[model samples]
Target: LAKTTQPISMDSYEGQEVNITCSHNNIATNDYITWYQQFPSQGPRFIIQGYKTKVTNEVASLFIPADRKSSTLSLPRVSLSDTAVYYCLVGERGQGGYNKLIFGAGTRLAVHP
Candidate 1:
């Protein structure tokens, strides 16, 4: 199984674009990489999921390499309100939904003035 690692904290000014990268060196072949963004008091929102190549939606974009060992999340024109924790989870989507999900310390993103 692949383990993910990301920045413990990051700071950015409002209106700046931010990119966070996660490394999963041992990612499995059937695993799906998912990215979630969490607010201070709210549950995480699904930002994007990708197996390979790139996936883009209204919230963010996920870029996965062919090796499937890492991914990047791009947040465009972020604001102070966007400050939150970002998690990169790599697991079996179908089997893990019913099981308890493990979380990392999480990357705390702080948007500044």
Candidate 2:
């Protein structure tokens, strides 16, 4: 598993774009970058996942460079409700084997009024 590095916390105002970057220098070739968002008292939910290049969905966009060593999760026009802890995870899906995703300390995002 690749270790992730992210900020301990971030501050943002409502209606602003928030981008969080995670680094994984020892990322494996079979590994994929996945982001999850967790609200208070709730479990983490999948935001986006990408192997290389870019991936977009209704909630967020994931950007991965050619090297696949790092990735960025982009949130557009965030609101106060978007305030949560974001996690960057690197792992491969199991193929007839038990595959587990390891989560590092997540980045806490604070959305202000």
lDDT of each: 0.87, 0.93
For model 1, what is the alpha-carbon lDDT of residue 52?
Answer: 96
lDDT for residue 54 in candidate 1, whole number 0-100: 95
Model 2 spans > 4 angstroms off = none
Per-residue lDDT value at 35 in model 2: 93
lDDT over C-alpha atoms for residue 94 of model 1: 73
TM-score of 1: 0.91
Q: Report the C-alpha lDDT of model 1 over 22-104, residue by residue, as the tens digit.
A: 99998878788888889988998878889999999998889998898889999999898889999998887777455234567
Q: For model 2, how does the per-residue alpha-carbon lDDT over 1-113 read when each residue is reduced to its tens digit?
A: 88989888999999999999999999999988989999999999988999999999999999999998889999999999999999999999778996688888899999999
> How many collisions per candidate?
0, 0
- Give the best candidate by TM-score: 2
Worst 10 residues of 1 by lDDT: 94-103
Which candidate ranks first by lDDT, i.e. highest?
2
